[model samples]
Target: MKRIWIIGLWIGFTLLCNPIQAQVINKPIVVLDPGHGGVDSGAISINGVLEKDIVLEVGKETIRLNRELFGNSLDIQLTRYKDILFSFDL
Candidate 1:
């Protein structure tokens, strides 16, 4: 539970800070959703940081990594590219 979130945060931060290089390929399509947006902040940290914020960064970082580190081999997309909340008003 907590451990998983912590580890995920660490991995996201690490990948964001330290970049890698790989060959480019365009075949797979990846979609990521940063859970609990808008009014729901999901989990909260001791420092008052919200889980939504953390996961949002992770999602963005995943896209960045795919483009820069992995040479765009993956077509990564996010449910919400911004910090805005998702709505079912479609």
Candidate 2:
């Protein structure tokens, strides 16, 4: 029984330490845009809910779901992880 347990542990450890390879595809990179942020505050609902806040929340959720489904095989990038002001002049 002890020998079986030791072998099981060894097998588990080996699998855990094994590295996973990501599959690459010849496709255009995906750009996620979570728009509206900073002091501007694009739109405000009747309940005082801000559009910027909603957009950011939805964007994060989408990213989480995509990563779970695709694993490390996908190359995903987001424009802004947090609220930030954008200037046209700059």
**Which is the leading candidate under TM-score?**
1
Residue-by-residue lDDT tens digits, candidate 2, 1-90: 999999999988876776341133543467777788888677999999998888888888877877798664455577778988676884
Residues 3-90 of candidate 1: C-alpha lDDT, one tens digit per residue? 9999999988986775542222425778888888888899999999999999999999898888798777787878987667877785
TM-scores for every candidate against the unseen true structure: 0.65, 0.62
- Give the C-alpha lDDT of model 2: 0.75
Worst 10 residues of 1 by lDDT: 18-27
- Among residues 3 or more apart in sequence or in different chains, the pairs in candidate 1 whose N, CA or C atoms overlap within 3 Å are none
Q: How big is the positional error of residue 70 in model 2, measured in Å on the Cα after superposition?
A: 2.8
Question: Against the true structure, candidate 1 has what lDDT?
Answer: 0.81
**Candidate 1 deviant stretches above 4 angstroms:** 1-26
